[model samples]
Target: MEYSEKKALAIKEYFAGGTTSTKLGLKYGFGNASVSRWVAMEKKKKRKFEEYAASIRAVREGMPTDVKALQEELRMARLNISLLEAMIDISDDQHGTDIRKKAGTRRS
Candidate 1:
């Protein structure tokens, strides 16, 4: 059975929040494999997972936006990240313990 894109996306969003496919399948009345496939397909459709996830987040928040709007929002976010990283760098210099986690470091 074919599901609507909206339904597939809703399932994908829930799955992203650490929900297992088997549980989601039982809740949504579909097979576990189907839930997995739907989530995988949604992820596979976009090249950049982070940006795709951001767009999905925006949509879920009830704000329908065009590509231009998304682009502008992304730009603003990048600027905010730059500002935050600068602040973190400054704070780290003034502190004893490392504040920022190194890339690929396992959480202890």
Candidate 2:
């Protein structure tokens, strides 16, 4: 992983637990003071992410159920789910066919 990604993951792990910055720095191979900076940067990124997510939720939740916006979202979700199910079914069918072919080949 890149240094930034590693640092971000470390910061996330630290915040999700009760670990100290010093301990995190030692474990993550960063300077003790760098841990504080990384944590702050991660917090800013998280705040921005949360804000964007909240806005999206608001747009979805505030829409009337009968409105086109809501209908479109529902339609999209249903389509996506259908596509995923179809893909899974195809994969399972292929796997089963392969297994049956292998079994027949072994018997012969």
Candidate 3:
């Protein structure tokens, strides 16, 4: 049976008042496992909502310093990659080494 919003609210209220899932399910006319599953789903939704709210609060407080740190790290990584590519090019030119690719293959 589809649970109406009112029924769901009543069940939640009953659950909050220390009612067991088995008791609530019997009272609500559903299986105990269904009540337990609904409660578990609600808990997961509540946690996800709290997490999103926290992230929103963090953004509102400031641009989240960790994000700035990560952006800086990414920029540094790109620069390092470019420098490494240049070094590889120079090494290949100077030593005639195929360090940039596997042996017997032209792809780099």
Question: Tens digit of lDDT per residue, candidate 2, span 1-108?
Answer: 789887877888889888888888888788879988878877899899999999999988877655977789999999999998788778879786432244435543
Q: Highest lDDT, which number?
A: 2
Name model 2 segments beyond 4 Å from true.
1-9, 65-108
Among all windows of 10 consecutive residues in model 2, the one with the lowest summed lDDT is 97-106
lDDT of 2 at 33: 90
Collision count of model 2: 0
The residue ranges of model 3 lying beyond 4 angstroms of the native Cα positions read 63-108
lDDT of all predictions: 0.76, 0.82, 0.81
1 versus 2: better lDDT goes to: 2
- On TM-score, the candidate that comes out on top is 3
- Comparing candidate 1 with candidate 2, which one achieves the higher TM-score? 2
How far off is residue 104 in model 3, in Å? 64
In order, how many clashes per candidate? 0, 0, 0
Candidates' RMSD to native: 21.4, 18.5, 9.4
Instruction: Supply the TM-score for candidate 2.
Output: 0.48
What is the lDDT, from 0 to 100, of the residue 47 in candidate 1?
A: 46
Per-residue lDDT tens digits for candidate 3, residues 1-108, read 357864686467655777787887777777878777888888889999999999999887776687788999999999999999999999999999867657677656
* lDDT score for candidate 1 against the true structure: 0.76
- Give residue 26's error in model 3 in angstroms: 0.6
